[model samples]
Target: MTQAKADIGVYGLGTMGSALALNLAEQGFRVAVTNRETAWIGDFVKEAGPLATALIPAETLESFVSAIKTPRTILFMIPSGAPMDAMIEAVLPLLAEGDTIIDGGNADFNDTRRRFKELSGTGAHFVGMGVSGGAKGARHGPSMMVGGTQHSWDQLRPMAEAIAAKFEDDPCVAHLGPDGAGHFVKTVHNGIEYADMQMIAEVYGLLRDGAGWDAPRIGALFEGWQEGPLSSYLIEVSAAALLTVDPETGQPMVDVIVDQAGQKGTGRWTVIEALKMGESANTIEAAVGARGWSSEKSKREIAEPLLTAGTLEAAIPSETDLEAALIAARIIAHAQGFRLLGAASEEFDWSLDMVRISEIWRAGCIIRSALLDDLATAFRDEVPHGHVILSPNIAETLAQKLPSLRRVVVAGASLGTALPALSAALAWYDSTRRGRGTTNLIQAQRDFFGAHGFARTDQDGKFNAVWPDLASEGT
Candidate 1:
């Protein structure tokens, strides 16, 4: 028996887990992995190839935990929720004091909190880590979000910093806060991603229906967008997805694909959190709604019979105007996401660092973009202002881009193309700027129906009004 010490033990050897293990091995860390089956274990070991020496395979749980030294670090990359809890239960007996268990899953933040509490005082540290950038990202570089104690982070930082994607030598990884905070931010990241993708699809719909452009035509435009302010991983992939030609039919690949969008629930979770926190994540909420509506084909078919397949109404908004509008819309959507995070931070006393979040997101994430560089800079000397929009540089940019956004929204409404995300973005912007909104009538209606009472603008106290007699009612 070649008795050797392993720096870390990875308990799952699925695609992402295997890739992460390989990445760890590549960084010169001795990675021990375990799974129920031996097939993936063999495949992983063989694939490790020249780097095989750094890979350790433990078929049993006891052997896996035994391979690591004391105060051991074991990372669980299993499915979130029940499976995660089960794994923890199975591993608890083998663990020692100061040992750490990191959950690298897309877990609900509430679930993460539960796990953190369950693992507390057991002499084992629990960390909820959010790993992004998919399979390739896991193998090469990923944006890592960690929530745990300072000591737990210290133990993991060296490996994390080494493996993460770097922007100007800055690693795309952060110890966001303590317990559930990392997963919460990651959940919101996915939400912003949903909004980004949905908005892109909405824009493409406008291009297709309003401009009478085919997939390749639109794809080429998206390709062009990759070079400009809208440059990002999502935009780049969108171009690829649109441009790909199906080998079987010799047609645009995107043309044959189904329109029903698939979701994994993070987007909905974000909207739920927003509602709970009373933060207006309207742009993201609209995107999630648009996806749900897309799945109701029967309702759409029924509605389609009654609607006109309208032609181009107004001239398609200029490319320049559309791009400018997209920039502003992107800003608003991301700001809403951060707004939610800020609220969560305050509510939980997480002391979340907004700048670090943006810095890490600059690379190895679906939402990675050049814009994050600007956002990071804007947050570098943040003056405790609640919104990123309040940053002088960002405010100046929004001021410049507002006109383009207005023009695009007006054109979309006039031409009758569905721009739900864009329209919501504009509505949110407008509502934020309005010091006096038309909510007085709403208050009055509430008071009349439920006696909920209302606050007067001229007075500081809450007031209730007695029902007034009308011509239709007896005095």
Candidate 2:
């Protein structure tokens, strides 16, 4: 048994936990790990291979706590809700004053805030870390968002960054802000992720329904787009999936796949929080709804009769047109998603650095892409809190693509394929360009109901239109 120095302890040995542990060990950090089942620790040690030399598995939280040095740092990689709560309760008593606990899971921001307060009294620091990039990223670095006091953040930043994904040579991790800001940003990230995935799914639907394309053909088209403006990790993976053929049946595999989708609750939680914040996240909500609806495929199929059940008959658009539309729509979707993220950062008073956030997403994060590098560049050159869509570079990109985006939205709607995100993206572009054209209807509605003052079209001053008296009275 190695005496615990200033080593980090990782509690939970699931896919994420194990990968993170391995990375930490590889970086020469003495790592103490514990799981409910002792056998899992053994499995982690074996999986870690050569890095296992630095790993020390503890049988219990008390043992783990006892082994670690003062100001010990422990990362919780368990599921959210009860399990997380239980782990905190079990470990808090064992931890000394000034020790730190990091929740490196998809925990609720509010919960993190509460935990911070709860643990602060005991002199233990609490950090809410939003980890992105799935299993692969976890094992080989991922983008990390951390929120805590400056002191605690300073202590942990090196380790966090060391294990994070990077853009170019820079780590894509940042000290998000105080309290629950990290988790909040992460929550919004998941929301955007949900919207992004749905957008891709909608594009696939358009290819299948409107273009009457087979999976292999659609996959090939996506592969081609990967070299153009629409290039992205998601698009690349989707193309690969499309190209996959079933060995036994020798057909396009996607055609026979089930429509059911799975969600990890973060997206739904983001929608709920957005409502609480009085923020517009229509695209994200629609995406979540789409996933939920997909889960009821049997019911949907039975209730909504298909008029034409044979192979798709609609004509596919020319490759040039399709590529142009896809790129345009993707840009718009990214804009809308990032706009929502910006709004959330403001609402939560997170003071998040959009540039660093974008940089992180450019690599190790699930939403990482070449496009995000452009966003990061735009952010670095602009003021913090500046609207991303209004950034000179982004605006130019949007202007260049707007026409094609409009065409794609029209085509998707006419074909009766669900493209909520794409539709919302088009709406965002239109709304921003019209310069208050979208606000007039709501302003008029307010005047009709409560007689709220309205801004004059000809001038900048606010004015209230008078209405004739309706109630009769002796004057």
Candidate 3:
């Protein structure tokens, strides 16, 4: 074992861990790697091919620690929560002062904050880094959101930038804020992702059922969308997925797959945290609900024949209108996500920079789109009342596209097509625009039944109304 030899150490040889280690090695940084399954170490180093010289495989944790130089940096690419806690406990004894331990996983921000505090005064620093782009991105270039002490950022920034995805010439990596800010941002990122996917699926559903378009036609439509404002990795992948034929059954790949969508809990976590903060993430909530609804496959199968809501004969929307509707819904979803980020920043005192967040997300991340460039400008130049949608450029864009969204939502309602995410976005937008919403009636009802006490429009204090009992009068 070479003592104080490698630039950094990576513990865990999982898909992401291996890829990231390889990426670091390929970037000319000597990397020390180890895993619980020690047998995989030799294999991983060997598979590195010519890059093998840059990789130092350690069969044990002690040797792995010894391989890294003073003020060592170790990235743990294991599952978050209990597994991470176990790794921390195991590795803490082996580390010296000034060492940095980075949790590079989709951790719950609450857990990250807890761990961050726990590591304080212990000499070693703990960094909660949210890494996006999956395995391939890890191997090539991924967007990294780092949240820790400034000291840790100073130590990690050089290598991070070297291995990160680039937009123009800028790396898609940033020290967002302290403690758990990175993970929180990543959580909202996934929530917005859920909304984006659901909205796209809703559009596909409308085209399939209402317009009676075949898979190939829908695939072509999605392919064409890639040329415009909607050009994004998700749209490109969706087009590819739609166009793929299942060679086994000679059917569209989607046709052979089950409808039940799988979730790994990040979307649900986003909704939970948003509600806890008293913030609105309606589109994300709707997306989470849609996934839950999807899981009841048996119930849906049984109810399909038994339930019937009378469907009105609906006019199919034009492709241009559909494109406009998707763009508008996407804007609403991202705005809601950013709003939640703002609320969280206030609550946590992280002072998150929305412009930097937008800039870093423009490449490597799944939601990378041209739209984010506009959002970055909105955050940088003029976001009135802390609302991105209120920015002049975004507001003008929304004004033009919202009518198309409204038309699509109405048509979907008339067709009896489920459009939870899209409908939620439209509803949120409408509610935001309304200067006088019917919430006054809701306040009155709450005060009437629960004596919650409503504030009067004409007065400064909360007031309760004394009214006749309607039930007694009816009897």
Candidate 4:
């Protein structure tokens, strides 16, 4: 138990871990770095370059723990779940009072809370830090969302922000809240990522199926959209992927790609949490379902003969029409995802600052883009809990573009191309315009049958239409 006060001690020298360590070292932080295998340490040191001398290879957990100063901060970059649990168990005995452990892996939020409680007895702090952006972003600066004690967060903020991505002079990292909030936000971020990617796929499918356009032409259309409201990193990459030709066949490489999609468990977890919280996350849920369904592509193909098919030969809409539709659908999908995040925040009592969350996602996170700035601005101008789609600016944006989006959805449905996010967004708009239909009907029925009071449509009165005679005294 030696007094220690270093900037970072990063364990597990994988790509993400190494990149983060490099970022910290570049920021002039004294980072003690180690991995389980000694050989990997040399490779990490080499990859880290000038930062190599600062890297300390710890052969044992005791040494790793002892290397950091008091109020010690050690970050775990290991595989999540059981492996992480085992590591925590191994290191807990070696850590001194007031030492902090940051779990930077994608561990479940519940596990974070449990670990936080378990470590508190030793006066040790546990911080669940949600680190996003891929390998490259990690080295440059990734978005970070952290949850733990306010005191612990305050201690970590400077270093975290120093190594974070920035947007319009604001760092793309924040103290989300206490306990599990960081991982929770990160979970929702993944859910939105799923929806965003699916929406892009739908746009690509509509263009390819309806226009008979080659991949390069479709890629060009995406490139044009990238300069407009529909612009995003996902769209940018998709356009590039479409333009790449297979060296062997000289055909568009996208054509040879499998129609199926894959997903990790985060999207599913988001959908489940949304269900538990009674939130409308149709777009996000649909995206998850779409991926699951796509995984059964072979079965779908087998069943195709039994299903009626429609031709996708409708005339291609104008670029303006396509752009407007895509933009509107994307906005709606994003709204649904944000709405879910809001609901989860409230449900979990996270007290999360929506504006900050939006700002973070506007830059280095996977969902980062210029569009999120508009979303953040919109959130800042209104009641924090206001319905996202009902925000004045968002409403106007959706109103002007809904028709074209509807047309796209119809075309996608007819062509049998999966467009779950598009469909969910369309349905959300419809429900918003008409009012949510199912719950109202159920409430009305409940009032009619059981005298459970319901609001009257004609007036402000609370009334009940009773079926008392049917439950007769004679019976």
Candidate 5:
């Protein structure tokens, strides 16, 4: 057993796992590390350099478990679906009562829930933890969302908070409910991230295609935006990407790269869950759809010339209007995400803290922004209408910024630009403000075709409208 007693056991030496192991070691916590490829364990320890003193290398799963102290806390940083299940099956036998197993990946929340239930009678505890901020954040400080039993939280809290990102000296880590709450929140965070990136890309397209602005010019503008309400990690990176010059070709780095966008299913999961819950996340849905459309590179290339709409010389919107439009669309997208979280919280009895979620997201996550500070403030008390956007401060901000979104969407439509995410955000916002909606006609049509009942606003119960038979009338 090598006589190595450690505070935590880290299984897997993937990019994220290695970074996190190093992070734990740097924080003065002894971390026992192992990998499926046993040879890599030595290399990982070597790469860790001075931090190697704190990393205990174990060649086998048994050795890994043995190196950790009693009532062990083991973190498996592997792929989410089947691999995680397999790891759980493999490790459960080696653990004892009061031991904890953590799944630290972008997991499907349903699976997290199932795993939690699966371990109910077993003595070992299961935790589903969401770690954000990418590999760099893992090595330094990442925002962490933890979900598990109170016992598991108590076991993991000290190490988790020690390695987590900070907002004004406050660690960006929280024990958010139990079972699937952490993973679910992370999914929605990625969904909002998708919308945020798509909206930013749309504005970049507008500047590049419609206004004929150079990449550096657009990049400079985005950099300046970081000082305002739009300040966030995505904006910072987008600016950095745009401003970078290719050494070999002397062109902008972004210009040389392929235009196709890639996704890893988290955004799609968010949309699917929202739909299943009878909620609307149109902006996120649109962002997912854009990524799908981006994947059809060959089809897009073939249809480019054949599907041309007559081009118009559209007026370019001012930078002020463009910034305002981004802020407005961003607000609506995040609001929709929050509503979905609220719905899930109610549905599963998670009792998620919206204010804390927003607060943690202010630093380490990809969607971290100055806007999240405002969102945290907005959710500090009960929102007026069960929605963040309806809060007085948020409502006033949206009212001030909405016209710019309208103008930008109109301009994009006129210019034949594909602004799916921005357009969807505007559409959702417009629908939200209307006390009466067009869905009544949809209900009427459903009743006419399928005898589905429709509720009348003037009456108490559902009623089917009497209508002329379409077949008889046509005959």
Candidate 6:
């Protein structure tokens, strides 16, 4: 029996996978859909009425691979770690020369890099693509960060752009670089995502716990902010979640929900890379820490009995000031994340375009915002020399907004509400802006203890002081 060739074969049928397949089919691609569980194929095709016509359902791995034509494209929308690798191993024997395999998951860049090398000479194109915007974005359009050989990208680019969210005429997808570059960028995206969410949570706590504002009031603020520079998907979603009352309990839904945040490792990877690169991303690190702290419910419960809740009411800052603070915190966290990316680009020779990255982030992603539009403009065509916050426009913005950040931080501190992300943001901004830091003492201490030697500000060469010489002199 002869079978028709599919333009693309999607190798999974989970929520995201299904959405992606539907999206491709909607875009007029003859898509082949597959899953380890054969049941999903029936469910998918039955649910997709008109679109189902363009979709070819496959019951087995061999059938799935066979449905796609020569120089085929296979996209794996599965878990990031071992499962993704296992699928690749199983698919490799089925793939022919010049075939393309795209990983649309939150995979580690190191693994992506290694896999690219491992698949070399097999003549298969292995791409690491980072797909964002969740289920809705998948079905409609997502921000796709693709990385692989130029040949594979040439084949995938049209379809990729067609299925990606657009800002005016620009698609929210680009070939970031070679293998691992897409996932590397996505890894930092999640890190910044964590920081952004944490900052939002912190400010919400300020309104609810410190300012004595109810969920509805706090939600209103988010709704208002959505119209401004801070407008973003997370803020929009937060507004909805904050305002929702349980119809059953007639109470705020947030009040009954657990405080713990679950992480799937990408945020932690951002911090790890920042550390390895010797770059500062304390804001993101703090966000990951906040999630960790939230998860230790038993310890927090035990500590709560002995801890004193702040009794003194701190004077509430103006709503304008709080909004400014939120905006400032958001900007700082983004700067830190981009700075990390800039560092990684040098190490990996990705030649990543900050403006392009920002453009892609302007739509079809969790972090999509008006701010990203501004960033896309601010990050010029050439590689930026410093952090995004230091750019003329952003610097002026920070100069105006930073004072508000300080006031909000003071308010949060006085009221005894935790503002780790907010506080770390201010700290990162301050440290980066300062011409002189107190690190001289740190250098001196390092030299005194370990004789590591320290570079002098007054001179070009490294120098060591006659420490108390307590150990050497037997004092």
lDDT of each: 0.90, 0.79, 0.93, 0.82, 0.94, 0.90
* Model 2: CA > 4 A from native: 1-6, 306-316, 383-385, 446-475
TM-score of decoy 6: 0.97
Question: What TM-score would each prediction reach against the true structure?
Answer: 0.97, 0.90, 0.98, 0.91, 0.98, 0.97
Expressed as tens digits, the lDDT of each residue in 108-221 for candidate 6 is: 999999898889899898999999999999999999888788988998997899999988978999999998999999999999999999999999998888778989889998
Off by over 4 Å in 5: 1-4
How many collisions between residues are there in candidate 2? 1
Model 5, 327-405: lDDT tens per residue?
A: 9999999999999999999999999999999999988888999999999999997897679999999999999999999
Give the C-alpha miss distance for residue 106 in model 2, angstroms: 0.8
- Distance from true location, Cα of 236 in model 4, Å: 1.1
Write model 4 residue lDDT over 134-215, tens digit each, in one string: 8888899899989998868877888999999988778999999888889888988888888888888877877786667789
Quick one: best lDDT, which candidate?
5
- The per-candidate count of clashes, in order, stands at 0, 1, 0, 4, 0, 0
Q: Supply the global lDDT for candidate 1.
A: 0.90
What is the C-alpha lDDT profile of model 3 across 115-204, one tens digit per residue? 999999999999999998889889999999999999999989999999999999999999999999999999999999999999999999
Q: After superposition, how far is residue 185 of candidate 5 from its true place, in Å?
A: 0.5
Candidate 4: which pairs clash?
3-70, 4-69, 4-70, 5-69
Span of 10 residues, lowest total lDDT, candidate 2: 308-317
Cα lDDT of candidate 3 equals 0.93
> Which of 2 and 3 is ahead in TM-score?
3
For 1-475, candidate 2 gives per-residue lDDT tens digits of: 6454637888889999988988888777888889988888777778777888888888877888776767788899999878888888988878777788999999998999888888877878899999999998998988888988886787787788788876678987888888888898788888888877888888888888776778998898889888877778888889999999988799878877888999988899888987876666777888899999989988888867755534433344456766665566556656655666677678777787887778777888887777887877888888334777777877787777777767777776666776787787677667667855766888877886688989887999887777555454533
